[model samples]
Target: MPRRSRKPARPTACPCGTGLPYAECCGPFHTGAAKAPTAEALMRSRYSAFAVGDESYLLRTWHPGTRPERLGLGDDRRWTGLEILEVTGGSPLHTTGTVRFRADYADAEGPGSQAERSAFERIGPDWYYTDARHFTP
Candidate 1:
């Protein structure tokens, strides 16, 4: 009898459901191997960053033109999960775009959530997260 090869592990589906896998989808970008094409990609990578606690990646993707002097990653707000509400106003590979998302998490007090309609700008072949408004829920 001939020996059979083992099956390979499947990559997780991208939260955005762009018909791509998480590993090949946003994983490389989240791990600093690739660049995002649109604002939505940056946003997705940031979500992945939070999921994996990659603080440095978060800072790198932040738009330097509008990035804050201090990104307090140590702020004690534990993230529980992420829910992408909607994605609109961008192409398959956008040069400029926007992403609206709802992120759910837990803290020292209790469960909480933040909804945001974030914008982005592409600068010098790089996509940067420009603006975000946190909504009260």
Candidate 2:
């Protein structure tokens, strides 16, 4: 029997709910091909990274001042959705901003959601996630 070569799977829609393909959406940011231009975009990319378990992207995009020494994303949890509720500042001309969102997920315990107001800071042309105030809903 002859061996058949398999092609790579195509990228799917972004997990951030942007209705766009992953390559045109968060893939660039994940690959360092581009930087997120706004706070909301950074937030979306961050959520997408979580969905795909890209720890390096998450750590690299996190602000050094507040970034933890390490991050542990267990394989047991599956991120299901992202909803952006609010955005402030984070413009092409602004250096600071915030994004409020709800990221839903499922684990052994069942389904749950995490709502947060995350702060971001821009250095030169790049946006970095600073910290977040988590909330219960």
Candidate 3:
């Protein structure tokens, strides 16, 4: 039988609002192939994980000090979008950082969004989500 070459699969859009392909954006972070380079990057990947219901990734990126035993991700909620409001000291030269963001979603009731300022810490080469404080307004 004659052999035929297969085409490479097309890249899908990432849900992190970065205007980048999932494979080049958050896919590698989700699959353990790579680590987010900054706190903002980690925050973006965490949002993508929640959108895709990758509870494991969420937990993995969470700081062990604050990571819960498990997550209760409900299928009822559908993540819609992510907006990064601000980023502070999250570069490669920083050991700690903060990211303020808003995440939109929809469920049985209606559309809703959550805003928060998240804290991140770099223990070694990887950044981990430490905590977050909800925004009121």
> Which structure is stronger by lDDT: 1 or 2?
2
TM-score of 3: 0.90
Question: Which tens-of-lDDT digit does each residue in 89-109 have in candidate 1?
Answer: 555456667777787777787
Candidate 2 Cα misplacement greater than 4 A, ranges: 1-11
**lDDT score, residue 90, model 3?**
86
**What would the TM-scores of all predictions be?**
0.72, 0.90, 0.90
* Residue-wise C-alpha lDDT for candidate 2, range 1-137, written one tens digit per residue: 99743322335999899999999999999999999999999999999988888888999999989898778876788889998998999997899999999999999999999999999999999999999999875
Candidate 3 on 1-114: residue-level lDDT in tens? 987433223239898989999999999999999999999999999998888888889999999999999998877888889999999998999999999999999999999999
Clashes of 3: 0
Worst ten-residue run, lDDT, model 1? 3-12
Off by over 4 Å in 3: 1-11
User: Model 2, residue 80: what's the lDDT?
Assistant: 90
Global lDDT scores for all candidate models:
0.70, 0.90, 0.90
Q: What order do you get sorting by TM-score, best first?
A: 2, 3, 1
